[model samples]
Target: MESQPESHLLKLRKDTKENVRKIYNLDKPGRLEEAIKILQHWIQKQDHILKKDWNADYLDKTLIASKGSVEKAKKQIDRLCTMKTLIPKFFEVINVKKELPTILDLAMVMPLPTQTEEYYRVILVKIDTKEIKPEFFMMYFQYCLSVAEYIKTHDYANGFILVYDCRELNLAEVITKISTVELQQFITLLIEGYGARLKGIHIVSESKAIEMLINIVKQFLSEKVGNRIHVQRSIEDLPKVVPKGILPVEYGGNEKSIKELQEEWLEAITSEEHMEHLKVMYKACTDETRRNAGKFNEEYMGMPGSFRNLSVD
Candidate 1:
């Protein structure tokens, strides 16, 4: 007889954590390709669970597979390809180096041998398990159009990924979603300008990436801008936020692991002595802050001056 447990969010989180640990602990992994087989088995298991009227089990199983290896991950996606089935809180762990650059409409990094110009890569990853709806595809299409318009207006050549092909619904009709206002303008101005094979006044083509900048800036300065959004979301650009002359992104200082920071902090700041000594503490806090800031600005952000003059107090 089959057993059933009630559904809960905490259960799903626990299941995901366990699965991620299991995957990370894979012992002397034979080949990366084997991850695909584990994923396929997971897909089958999930399909069977839901078919048996076990929603909670289905969700737990799906979350586990979501964090599996890329091949397994892609197989996990087989259970979720439709826009109608996506649940909003869903998440999948993916490696930035291996998975992201390939699944999108444009490659952010050209393959090794090409002459493509290199530019800073900015990306935003939004994870949702929102029971995927057909309307969601429309939302994605609009977002892509907006991104393209922003890029074009700013003279930036960036790439994007809508990444909603996880639910079990057929994503084929995503075509319908792509026919929004921004894409329409891109077709007329960019595609037609280059005499493209237009799709009857609907659909975005590769050429429309040209207009992403124009639309993005307009929305940023317009009523559409919101507090929740950022132009860049990945921590990859963290070091770059500070001026680069002093601390470089590639330098060992800025890139030091969290363990190293904790060690350094413990070695220097004794609670009693630093607290009692005012001038010594002031010089340590202010001068150290300035030095670190100066290093960060000169080396990471390319700022002209060190941040020594700015007083913390």
Candidate 2:
């Protein structure tokens, strides 16, 4: 993989020896090994759908994120694999430079260089309706998956701090451009299928658009996720919850501006090396055989009515 600035990679607040033991059950003589064995057994049952070389590290992270529950880890892995194949529009073969350059500009998704004191990775999102094209929602979904893929290997442990700058977009544009169903799909994928720990979400918007967005989010997200939401009236108010030092200059922080960070990401994701890496990550371990097994739900294949039945499960 191409190297990023040291800051872009996840940095733990402290040594995680105790957390590793607790989350992965490494202290128990056989618990860690048993978890691996269980995942391996489950993989084999899928007819070699998961790559033969799927490493212990990947399964270990899944196990850790599932809070050491083998059953939950199994479900997480299955959901991820099935969704990748089931919804190829988002996961199949993403050529962002060609397919989504416009939507990427409209909804800028990138990680902050600094993490919280508790080691949570901070993700920044700013949606500008002025730049939005008609296909913004689907493209934004692709951008989100790109962000999730980047963090999956890097920031799986400490969870995430999601910061949304809602000032640029208003209620009218939001309600029309970003439908309730589309929002539900995005939230469902992040919370359930992605398997990342979500620490909290902060929405900074002076207008009442914050309430509108929050109400829509509350419809699909669980109380656990809903309660973690912190609404701020303005960008200045963010410092009280998220220290300014960890934010970019665009958000009144000391770091680089959000535009600069977005440009850096744009160049990186469009580059030849990063594009190849994304292709591998997208296609790897996708189980077409499992899909053909006739056990998956076809109704949950794509957006529209697909998300109506999905909760934080």
Off by over 4 Å in 2: 1-8, 14-34, 48-52, 131-133, 271-273, 284-313
Tens digits of per-residue lDDT, candidate 1, 1-313, equal 1111221100122233333435544323443235545544554554312222212323333333243344444333332231111211111222222333222222121101111122211221222232434444334433333233222222111121111111222223333333344333333222221111111111112232323533543442223322212232223333343222222123222333333432332222222332233222112111222234444345323211222333332
Total clashes in model 1, counting residue pairs 3 or more apart in sequence or in different chains: 55
Please report the candidate that would top TM-score against the real structure: 2
Model 1: residue 167 alpha-carbon error in angstroms: 34
What's the lDDT for all of these models? 0.27, 0.68
* lDDT, residue 224, model 2: 88
Candidate with best lDDT: 2
Using alpha carbons, what is the TM-score of model 2? 0.82
Estimate candidate 1's alpha-carbon lDDT, on a 0 to 1 scale.
0.27
Alpha carbon lDDT of residue 208, candidate 2?
60
